[model samples]
Target chain A: MTDIAGSATRVADIQAAYLAQARSKRVMNLILIVIFAALLIAGFRTADRRNAGGFWDGLPNILDFPADVIGEAIERAHLLPGYLIKYLPSLIETINIAGASTLLGAMAGLVMSLLVTRGLGPVPWLVGPLRRVLDILRAVPEIVIALVLIFMLGGGPVPAMIAIALHTTGALGKLFSEVNENASLRPVEGLASVGATWTQRMLLGVVPQVAPNYLSYALLRFEINIRASAILGFVGAGGIGYDLRNTMSWGAGKFDEAAAIFLLLFLSIVAVDQMSSILRHRLTHGAKPGEIHR
Target chain B: MSAQALHQQTRRNFNRKRLMSFALPGLVLGYFAYIFMAFDMAGLGVRVNLENARTLVSDAYSYKTHVTQDNRTGAVEIAIEGERKGAYAPGTAPGWVRLGETSEIDLGGGHVVTFGGRVTYDVPGYGLVMAEPGAGGVNASLPDGALPDFISLSKNRLMVKTDAGRLTVTRNRAEVFKYSLGWELFFFTLDSPYHGMSPGALFKAAVNGEAGAIWQGFVGNKMWRHGDVGWALLETVLMAFLGTCGAAIIALPLGFLAARNFTPLGGLRFAARRMFDFLRGVDGLIWTIVLSRAFGPGPLTGSLAILLTDTGSFGKMFSEALENVDARQVEGITATGARPLQRYRFGVIVQITPVLLSQVLYYLESNTRSATIIGAITGGGIGLLLTQAINTQKDWEEVSYYIVLIILMVMLMDSVSGWLRRKLIKGNGGGH
Candidate 1:
């Protein structure tokens, strides 16, 4: 009977401890939620105040610009094809900028990745400095370089291409190095034992293993670069975006052209996005067992 | 399969791989050749401005002080960057300049310029070049021999360019530019009381209870605008914070509706998925343009643009996460007779919070960069200041300052978000 009573007291003590712990956890969660909510509200208020137009006042008019563009396109439906054809060259230029930059950046990134990866690199001391170089390249927004280059090189596709390519180099270098870290070192070691140079080893051994992943990442970067190229164009780097800005600046009467350009841009972006996604999916997952490989 | 057939297949694969290895690079090369022509590479040499490049690079690290003598008034004044705000008092000048009726500027390295009755530039290798400005236009005299390439002489104006300094004399004004190696008025403007105070002196002053006054001057500096820069940085971070958290909050429920496992209604799921695609397809640039129309340019527009674009991304990722969640937990909760809401809260949200939090945090870091770019377009944040400074085309030092701050800001955010992700993910793992 005494042993049963002692066991009962122990059970009671365990329940009290659990309940107290749960209550404190609940209080802590509540405090965090309250603080988060307060921050959100305060941030919104500050943003609204700083904005040129208040949020509530501007909220209702959000659809006005889109509506105007759509309405103008509908009215000038016949001229839409002409506008599209007229701007196709610029669109192609934008796409070309993206493609060229992606290609160049990926090649540079591949080499840099090999140089920065531990055990795979020829010179071990280069890793830290190269990593910091990549960091700086990634940190600088394309606009900064593009604008500066535009001042020197004048408004054109080259400045935008170089700027975007430099950024892509940094971004892809870091990502590729991370992929390299997970890659098998056996192939590199085997090639090294055979007196193969760093370049030969990396190209012959490592590249084959990581090519699919690199291609997938490069494809994703291409999609991003297309958008970046368009933006750079808006800032006077020569492309469809420059035309868009011109049409938009003309306002009211020329919105039809703007709408057509918008349609072209939107459609092309979606097309590339879809294509890249499918390709990336295939690259990452591979084909079915019975299917022939690319 | 026979050994002969298998061997043939292997041989064919090798041949195809070898063909691909050559053809792929060839294709890329062909494309680049085309781009070279399309982007006008051949003509780029003629279009390129080496002078502008030199100015941009040089001005980025150095500043020039101007010693001017107004031809009309015959009054001399010294100023940094020739800005009225950076001008010294009538009786005051930098240590390198001796103030008098005839001010003498030591440009260093045996190069000197005297702004007095007649502007005289003393070059080390070249002889003294003198120019007097009056109503009849610049009356100039150079060395007896042929004029050097550095000097550009015209009827109304005379200009001399040297490594250490440059001199320009016109009918209206005569000015000498003395290049220096550091940014001027960076810490404190000419108007500030502590304009040239050393750190030790500043510390001593602070101890003497003048700290607040000194800080006020530094923060309120018209040239550097330290206070404004601090606020701009905060705004940029706020944009990333508001956008990421707001998207996460808005995407959670939409994610549930879109998830195959959570929602039985096929039509609702399809609609939600399509919405996500449409939002993501629109692109942040277009969204920035559209939002800026209604909201005008500011942090609000930038944040909203980020929010709208990220909402689709987060929704799609979240739904994918939700679909992959284990059903066993939900079944266990249902066994306890839990309501649908309670089942989701205890079962689904708990499991996916780590994934969702990590994705959101990662985006928070990237969005800081996006915010900066958007801010440039929308006319807000440090990006706006940078663009404005660049447009002016003379304030390269200011541009460099903003660039450094932007880089530091991005790196800081990157590290902070990374740390938070590691902490939260590990915390969740341990709790389970």
Candidate 2:
């Protein structure tokens, strides 16, 4: 009977200890949440203070611009089709810039990935330096390159293409190298045994293993590049964004044209986003039973 | 499962693989061919400005100091990059420039230019070129024989260009440009007392308790604007932090409302999801343009633009995570007599917090870059400074400086976000 009493006390002691730990954990969480909330409020306040217009003052006027644009667009609904057709060439130019850059970037990224991946690369010493090159490339904003190139290349699609391509190479290189790390080396070794060159081995042995993943990533990058190309165009690299900027500068009356460009841009972005998602889904998760060899 | 059928299948697979191997590259090549014409690659050569390229490349690594003599007053002035802020004091000049009535500028490598009543450039391998700026325009004399391509002469102006330096004389002034390596006036402007001090001397002066003055000079540097740059960098990071964290906050509840399992009302879920889609589809560029109109171009505008676009993304992603959550945990919490809110706090929130945190942190790093781009559009942060510097076209060194800072900032953010992700999401799962 005395042993049973001791056991009951031990159970009570364990329960108390657990409860104390639980109480401290709750307090810590509460403190964290409070701090987070405080930070958010402070950040918003600081931003509002620094802003040209106060947040509260601007809040009511937020919908005014959108409403005006929409109203004008409805009034000029008949001209909308003409404006879209007129800007079709520019839109196509923007899409082509993205496509060409994605292709070029993917190609360069492929080579860089093969050269930088640890087990797959021919030169072991080059890995660190090449990785840094990719890092710097990835770190640079596309607009920086595009602006400089626009100054030198005279503001066209080419500068945007080159800028986007360079950034893509850097971003895709890093991603591709990661994919390369996961690739099996058995096929590479088999190719090497037959005295295949490094390029050949990488192309035949490694690429086939990682092709689907690479394509998926490249497709995603293409969607991003489309946005980047449009932004670059706004800075005078020549695309639908250039037209948008021109119309925007004209203000009041030309807002309908701006609205049309906005509509086209939105629809295209949504279409690309949807299409790429479907393609990426196929590339990643839709491998049929007989497609394992790929 | 006959041998004949298996052999036929293998042959067919090989044929398809071989066809694909050739067809893929062919398709790509055809696309590139079309792109070549579409982008007007053939016409690009004529439009390319090699001179601007040369200037950009040379200006990036080197700076020019201007030594000018006004014809009207016969007074010589030496300034770095011809900027009034970088002008040497009335009686002071660099060692390469000898300040006197007849100031001699050693452009290095036997290229010496004398500026006095008339400007004379002594070319080592060639002969001396002299020009006098007077009422009758720059009467210039060059070495005998065929005129070299380096020298261009007109009735009013004469310019002698060499690898070492360049000399130009017109009716108004005679000027010499001496190019040197590295950014000039980077640490302290000529107005600063510590302008020309060596690094060792600076250190010694700091040890002598002049550290504050030295730092003041460096930070308040009019030319480089180090203090402004520091603030810009901070503002950029703040934009990213506020935008990303704010998006996560706004999206968490919206994500739950959009999630199929969490919100029983189909219409509410559909509305929430569509709201996300519309927000994302409009794109950050449009958001930036629209918000800048209301906010009038500042960090607030940039952060809001990022916040708006990322809310859509985070909402969609978070809802997916909420839907995929295990139901057993919620059931277990409910069985313990927990209320609806308590069940979500203990079961649902705990399960999704790591996923949400990791995604939010990942967006924080990328959003830094986005914030920079938006800043350029909205006229805030380092992006504005970068664009302003680049637009000047003559401040390539500053452009390079901003580029380096941007790269460092992005990389630093990248690593910080990675570290936080690892710490917060330990053993739970991985992030994109």
Candidate 3:
């Protein structure tokens, strides 16, 4: 009976200690939360001070521009379809830029992935340098290259295409190489034993294994490239974004045109977003029984 | 199934595969062909400006010093890149330039230019080209031979280009541009006493208590504006940090609202989901444009733009993560007699915090790059500086400098975020 009583006392002491630790942990977390909140408040204030207009003052006016555009667009709704039709070619140009760049970039990225992947690389020493190359390519904002190219190429879709492609290559190369790492090397070794060249082994053995994932990643990149291409056009690379900028700069009288362009961009982005997601879903999880082998 | 039937099926599948392989390549080829015409690749060759390319490439590595003489005032000025900020003070010139009544510029390969009443260029191979700027025109004479293509002569302007330098004499002024390697006035402007100090000497001076002075000179350098660039970089990082963190903070609760398991009311869930979709569909470029309209082109607008766009993305991702959370943990918390908020705090939040934090951190690094691009459009951060430098056309050295800094900044952020991710999510399934 004395032993049981002693053990019960020890158990109560241990529970008290655990409660103390938990309470202290809660206090520490609360302190952290307070500090984080303080930082957020301070950051917002600093940003407000640095901004040209105050946030509170600007908040009310946030919807003003959109409303004006919508109101003007509604009044001139008759010209909306005509404007959309007129700008259809520009929209197509933008989509074409994205598609072409994605294609070119994916091809470059595929080769790079093959060259850089651990088990599949032709030269081990080249991997580090090639990875750094991709990192630099990815690091550079497309505007930097696009603007520079615009200076040299005299303003066209080509500069935007090249800039976006370079970036996409870097992005997709990293993703593709990651996918390549998970691929089975058995087929590659078998092909190598049969005296297949490096390129043939990669194309026939590794490519088939990772093609679905690569396609999915490339499709996602294409979606991103579409937005990038549009933004590039805003900086004078030529497309719907250029038209939007033109209409925007014209300001008051051209709100309807701006609205039309905005609608087109919105619809296209949403459409592409939906289509790519669906396609990626299918590629990843909906592979047919026979498709897996290929 | 018989072996003959299986063989027939295999043959049919191989034929289909063969047909698909050919068709895929053909389709891709056709698309490329269409793009070629659509993007006008044929006209691209004609559209390219080789001269601009040469200038951009050469100017990125070299700077030209301008020696100009005003015909109206009889005053001579020497400036780097012909910028007023880079102009040399009176009675001061580079060692290569001898300042006197007639300034003699040594263009190094035995090529010398003397600027006086008449500008004389002594070319090593082509002899002398002399030009006199007058009220009527630039009376000019070149070496007596077939006039070389390098020399462009006219009634009003006489331009003599050589391997070492270029001299142009006009009706109002005579200017000589001598090219040199490296970015001049990068560390110190002409006004700084430490302008031409060697590294060894500068270090010695710094050791001898002139460190603050030297640092001030460099930071306040008018040509490079290191102080301004540093601030711009900080502002960019700040935008990213505030945007990403702010978005995560705002989206966390909204994610709960959108999650089907958490929010029982389907109407609220639908509203939250559609709100996220609307925010995302508008895109960052549009948000930047719209926000900049209100905030008037600054870092705040940039941050807000990023915040809004990322909120949508984070909302969707966070909701998905919340939905996938193990329900047993929440049930156990409830069994402990915890309140609803406390249960969620220990259950769902604890479970998804790693995923949420990792995603937020990943976006932080990417948002740094996005902030740069947005900053360009909104006229904030390093992007603004980069765009402004590039727009100046002759500041390719500065452009290169900004580009290098931007790449370094991004790489630094990438490594930092990657390190944090490893440290924070090491044993968690969230590890990349």
Candidate 4:
């Protein structure tokens, strides 16, 4: 009985030693993790201080100016009634900018895409340079381009359309090229073998395969363009961004109305998102391997 | 037999037509270039540089351009192409140009006679160039030493390189950059005695301008007394660097958690995964507005904006990385009766560090541009300086310098990230 007890104690000692070593290893890992976390925390603190002015400077105004400036306006304009009347109309106008820009941009994109693919067929040394030009157009954002147009057009929707269209062309051209590359090579090659023209091949063999995806992408871009249009208004390009900026600047602290606008925009975006998925799924049904029979 | 020959001839004609098919691309590019230059001139700062040679007049010059024209001749007022380009063109008139106190005569047919501090002619539109001020000489014969930063003497035509791309300058008319810069890194931008302008042309107008025959172009600027360009530069770099670091901190854990394959199916993990997509769905600038509102406006806003946006972006990416890992290792751990967490820690996490590091580095590099835009909006960093430059729209030479610095910074960041990506992720396509 004593021998049996001694053996049990020895086994217990070995188990405890192994457990302690394991615990120490975990503790070391935890220490390293803490150090990393501390470093990140420090970074955030520094970043916050650097940006403190952005949040704090408007505070005294956010609180006091809302009462001083906006309170009078609210009383003077008859408050709730005036805002309620103008809000939906203003929102619609903002929506209009997105609609117009997206339409114009999509059309331009379609044409530019054809040009990018050399659907008309490779022409000259200058054609190679066209790719370069497209690169430049794609590199700068649309709003930046719009700023220039605004100067030329004098604060209107024309510049906004131009900017959106130029960007859409670039983006679509890229997508188009990718589509062209992925199109049914056999059909296109078969057309080519018969000495069919570049235009013929593109029209018959290429466009069909990717048209659905292209449409879906264009719709997606339109949704994005809507939001972008709203923002560009801040720079005086024309849209709700202008209104948002003015209201905020004038201390129109009716965050409820603002919140409503945001909510509407969010819903629009979500609807667009769901639509895109549905459309894309329909277009590429069973695109995943083994999902459907060829 | 003649009929057969005729049929062969027709087939040959069709092939030739195929080659000619690309001619439209040239027309398209030509039209695009024209529109770009025109918009830049109308006080929209959009420009495009082609390898520091000639301004493609796209992204290097004008900084930005927006115009709506239908086919045929798209009439847009271009700022033209030079630091002093639109100095002759007036400022801030709706339809008319200022045309400054300078005069340019378009000799109609690819020749422009320019008069300011110097008299010179640029060849009509690139492919060949010459500026003749001295008696009886082509651009090549213009007294030995007047060439821009990158002039190609090898070609029969004189090509002046600007924006890191050479162009046969002034084959048409003298245009200008409506911006200005002081003697800030002037020598670096130039390749020593570049710009075929005699010292008289470059320096004669400056307050302490001095002119010599061959290198007389040494002029000191007095108009742009330094206000706030230097500190702004440091802030710009810091904004980009800190923005990237902050983003990485947010991205790493979320990336792991959001990874589709690694995370166990539960409400908590599922919510985290969905959060990644939702965050990434919105644009970076949009986030800037929200965070700037919440965190206050500054580089911090820009940085946080980037952090939030990139967390979503990287989470989606890391999830894919986790999915792509070799499953054999996980199987080995599981066979030993390791817990799911242990299997993940030893099997997946250890393998994907390199991928995470490399992707984070790339995102950091990309965020530099985002940082600039955010800074521009939030009123912080060099973008504030850039915004101020745009607001004034008169000192394009300075804008040019700022643009050059920004581009250089971008290049530096790209190279650094590429190096880091390569170092971390060996024998693989480093985080596309």
State the TM-score of the second chain for every model: 0.96, 0.96, 0.95, 0.48
lDDT of each: 0.89, 0.90, 0.89, 0.56
- Higher-ranked by DockQ: 2 or 3: 2
> DockQ for each candidate?
0.49, 0.49, 0.47, 0.12
- At residue B190, give the lDDT of candidate 4: 28
Q: Which of the numbered candidates is closest to the native, going by highest TM-score?
A: 1
lDDT of 4 at A124: 46
Interface RMSD of each: 5.8, 5.6, 5.7, 9.4
Per-residue lDDT of model 2, residues A220-275, tens digit only: 89988999999988989999889989999998999999999999999999999899
Model 1: lDDT of residue A251: 85
Kindly report which residue stretches of model 2 are placed more than 4 angstroms away from their true locations once superposed.
A1-17, A286-294, B1-9, B207-209, B427-432
The better-scoring model by lDDT among 2 and 4 is 2
lDDT of 3 at B432: 36
lDDT of 2 by residue, B212-244 (tens): 999999999998999999988888888999999
Between candidates 2 and 4, the DockQ winner? 2
Residue-wise C-alpha lDDT for candidate 1, range B1-432, written one tens digit per residue: 999999999999999999999999999999999999999999999999999999999998999999888878888888899999899988888999987777888999999888877888899888899888887778899889987899999989999999999899999898889899988888899989898889999999999999999999999988778999988988888898999899999999999999999899999999999998888888888898899999999999988999998898899889988897889999999999999999988988889888788789888888888888888888788778888989999999988899999999999998999998888788666223
Say which docking band candidate 1 falls in.
medium
Question: Model 3 segments beyond 4 Å from truth?
Answer: A1-35, A286-294, B71-74, B132-139, B207-209, B427-432
Docking class of 4: incorrect
Tell me which residue pairs clash in candidate 1: none
C-alpha displacement of B252 in model 4, angstroms? 4.3
Clashing pairs in 3: none
Candidates sorted by TM-score, best first: 1, 2, 3, 4
